[model samples]
Target: MKILITNDDGIYSPGIAALAKIAAAFGEVRIVAPDVEQSSMGHAITHSRPLSLKKSPIAFDGKEAYRVNGTPADCVALGLHIYPDTEVVLSGINMGPNLGNSMWHSGTLAAAKQAVLLGITGIALSTPVGKTEPDFNAFADYVKEALEVIFENKKLGLYNVNFPPQPKGLRWTRQSVRLYDGKVVPALDPMARKHYWITVTPLEQAEEGTDRWAVEHDFVSITPLRLDLTNEDELKKQLDSAVELNKQL
Candidate 1:
C-alpha cells in the first residue's frame, strides 16, 4: 500500500517523523506538510496565492519528505496530486489531542479529511501533550496496533484516532457531543500591548463510549467519520410538517 503522510505541526515536528517511521511498516510512506506550524487552521485552502512544496530540511529516516507553504488541507491536496497512486493518507501524531468538538477546526483532522474528499482512505492520529513534548516511543506499539485494526475496515473512509500516554487497549468510539463555555482571556504581551486569547472549557464531563471518554481512560480511541453533515431526522421532521401544513391549507 502506498501511504502519504502529512500533519499540521509542520515538517520539522517529531510527531510526523515518529508517524512516518511506524507507517513505513504498513507500506510506502511519503511526507508532505506545512513548513511551519498551522494548528487549528481547519480545512482551509489557499486561493489567493499559489502554494509551493520544497524538500524538508529535516529528514525522516530515509522517507521522501517535503514541506509546503500551505495549510494541512493544502498539503494533502498537493501530495495526492504528486503521488496519485497513494492508497492511504495519514495525518498527525499531532502535538495535541483532537477529540470531541475540537475536530471542527482541527488542521490535523483537516489533512485527513482532504484525503477522504479525494476518494482515498484518510486517518488522523493524535495524542495529548504535557509540559514537555509527548514520548512517542512509548506509544509506538499502540499506534501500530490501531492502524492494523483500522485497515481491516475497508468501508471506513475517514477516521480520527487518539492515543493516551499509555494505552491499555483500543476502542471503537463515537464523537463526544457536549456544550462548551467559550471565553476570551485578556492579557498583556511583552510589548505591553493588549491582547486576548480565545479559549473554551467543556461544560460537562466525557460520556461513556465516546472518543473523549475512551482516551481519558487510557484507551486508544478510533472514531470513524463521514463527510455528510445533514441532520436527516430534522430534515424529515420539517418535510413532514410542511406536508401537513399544505394539506390544511
Candidate 2:
C-alpha cells in the first residue's frame, strides 16, 4: 500500500515521527505536512495565497516528504495531488485527542476528511494528554491494529481514533454529544493590555459507548466519521410536516 502521512502537529513533532514509523511497517510512505503547527485549524485551505511546499527531510522511512505553508487539509490536498497513486492517507498521532465535538474544529481530523473528499480512504489518530507524557512506542500495537481494521474495510470512510493515556484495548465507539462549558478567561499582559483566552471544560456524560467515555475508561476509541452532516431523521420529519401543513392550508 502507498500511504500518504500528514499531521496538524507540524512536520517535526515526535507524534508524527511515531506515526511514520508505524506507517513505514505497512508500505511505502510519503509525508506532506505543515512547516508549523496548524492545530485546531479545521478544514481550512490556503485560498487567498499561493500555497508553497518544500522538501523537509525527517527521520521517517518515507520515500518522499514535503513541508507546506498551509493547513492540514491543504497538506492532504497537495499530497494527494502530487502523488496521485496514494492508496491511503493517515493524519496524525496528534498530541491532543480529537474526540466528540472537537472533531469539527480539529485540523488532525480535517486532514483525513479532506482525503476522503478526494475519494481516498483516510484515518486520524490521536493520543490523550497525561502527566506521564507520551511514550509513543507503547502505542505501536494499538495503532497497527486500527490500521488493520481500516484496511480491511475500505468503505468505512473517515475514521477518528483516539488512544487513552494507557490503552487497554480498542473499542468501536460513537461520538459523544454534549455541550462544553467554554469560557473566555481574561488576563492582562505585561504592557497592561487586557487579553482573553478561550478554554473548555467538558460536561460529563452519563452515557457510555461514546468516544469520550471509552477513552476515559482506558479504551482506544475508534469512531467512523462521515462527510455527510445531514440529519436524515429530522429532514424526513420536517418534510412530512411541511406537506401536511400545505394540505391544511
Candidate 3:
C-alpha cells in the first residue's frame, strides 16, 4: 500500500518523523508536508500565493520526502492531485493534542479531512502538551497499534487520534460534547504596534464519554471523523415540521 504522510508541524518536526518511521513498516511511505508550521490553520488552502514543492533530503528511516509551502490541507491536496496512486494518507503525530471543539481549528485534522474528501482513508495523530518536550515513543506505539487495527478491520473509518502527555492505553472515543472557551489576548509589538493573539483556554468542566475526557483519563483517544457534514436526519425532521406548519398556516 502506498501511504502518504503529512503534518501541520512542518517537515522537520520529530513528530512527523516518528510517524513516518512507524508507517514505513506497513507499506511504501512518502512524506509531503508543510515547509513551516501551519498549526491551527484548519482546512485552509492557499489560493492567493502560488504553492512551491521542493524535494527534501530529510528522511524518516530513508523514506522519500518532500516539503510544500502551504497549509496541511494543501499538502494533502497536492499529494493526492499529483500522486493519484497514494492509497492512504496519514496526518500528524502532531506535537499538541487535537481534541474536543479544537478539532475544527486543527490543521492536523484538516489534512485528514482533505484526504477523506479525495476518497482516500486518513488518520490523524497528536500528543498532548507538557512542560517539557513530549515523548514520541509511546505515541509511536499507539500509531503502530492503530495501524494494525485499521489494516485488519478494513471497515475502521478515518480517525482523529489524540494521545495524552503519556497515555496509558487506547480508547475508541467520540468527539467532545463540550465547547472551548476561546479568547483573544491583546499585545503590542516591539515597534509599539497593537495586536491580539487568539488563545484557547480549557473549560473548567468536561462531560463524560468525550474525547477530552478520554485523553484526560490517560487514554489514547481515537475518534472516527467523517467528511460528510450533512445532518440528514435533522434536515428531514425540519422539513417535515415545515410542511406541517405550512398546512396549519
Candidate 4:
C-alpha cells in the first residue's frame, strides 16, 4: 500500500513529522505539504499564481518528502495528479483541533476532501484544541490507534477525525449540530491602520451524541463527512411546491 501524507501546518511542523512516522508503518509514504502554514484556508486552490513543487531532503524516518508552495488542497491535487497510483491520502495530524464549525474553514480537512473528489479514500486527522500551548505529545498514542482503525476499514470515505487534548478512549461520532459563536478582534498597527482577526468564541450549547460533545467528554471524535452539499429533502419539497404553483401559472 502506498500512502500520501500531507498537512496544512506546513512541511516542517512536528505534527506532520509525527504523522509521517506513523503513516510509514502502513506503507511506502510520500510527503508533499505546504512550504508554509495554510491553516484555515479551506479548500482553496491557487489560480492567480503558479504553484511550485520542490524535492526536500527532509525525511520521515528515511521516507521521501517534498514541499509545495501551495495550499493543503493543492498538495493533494498535485500528489494524485502526479503520482496517480497512490492508494490512500492521509492529511494532517494538525497542530490544533478541527471540530464543530472549524471543519468548514480548515485547510487540513479540505486536503482530504480534495482527495475524495478525485476518487481516492481520504482521512483528515487533527490534534486537540488548546490555548497558549498545544499538547500534541499527549495525543500521539491516540493518533496511532485512530490510524489503525482507519486502515482496517476499507469502506470509510472522506471524513474528519479529531482527538481530544488527551482522550480517554475513542468514539464514533456525528458532526455537532451546533454552530460557532464567532467574534472579531480589533487591532491597530503602528501606522494606525485597523485590522481584525476572526476569533471563535465557543458553542453556547451542543446536543448530545455529537463530535463536540465526545471531545468535551474526553473521547476521540470521528465524524464521517461527504462533499455533497445538496439538500435532497428540501429540494424535493420545493419541487412539489413548484408543481402545485404551476397549476395556477
Q: What are the per-model C-alpha RMSD values against the true structure?
A: 0.9, 1.5, 1.9, 2.0
Tens-place lDDT digits, model 1, residues 4-87: 999999998999999999999999999999999999999999999999899988978888988999999999999999999999
Count of clashing pairs, candidate 2 = 0
TM-score list, all predictions: 0.98, 0.95, 0.92, 0.92
* Model 3: pairs clashing at backbone N, Cα or C within 3 Å: none
Lowest lDDT 10-mer window, candidate 2? 56-65
Supply the TM-score for candidate 1. 0.98
Report, for every candidate in turn, its global Cα lDDT versus the true structure. Answer: 0.95, 0.90, 0.86, 0.86
Off by over 4 Å in 2: 131-133
lDDT of 4 by residue, 1-249 (tens): 889999999998888888887777777888899999999999999999999999875767777788999999999998887788898899988878788888889999999999998888899998764565456777878888888887787874887898877689998888875656689899999999999998886666766678888888889888889788899999999999999999979
Residue 142, model 2: Cα distance from true site in angstroms: 0.5
Q: Which regions of candidate 1 are displaced past 4 Å?
A: none
Lowest lDDT sum, 10 consecutive residues, model 4, at: 128-137
User: What is the number of residue pairs that collide in model 3?
Assistant: 0
- Number of backbone collisions per candidate: 0, 0, 0, 0
Candidate 3 C-alpha lDDT tens digits along 1-249: 899999999998989988888988898998999999999999998999999899886857777788999999999999887789998899988988898888889999999989888888888989876786678885677778877776675653588888886668878888985656789999999999999999887765666777888888988888887777799999999999999999999
Regarding lDDT, does 3 or 4 come out ahead? 3
Tens-digit lDDT track of model 2 for 152-229: 886738899999777899999999988889999999999999999987878877259999989989899999988889
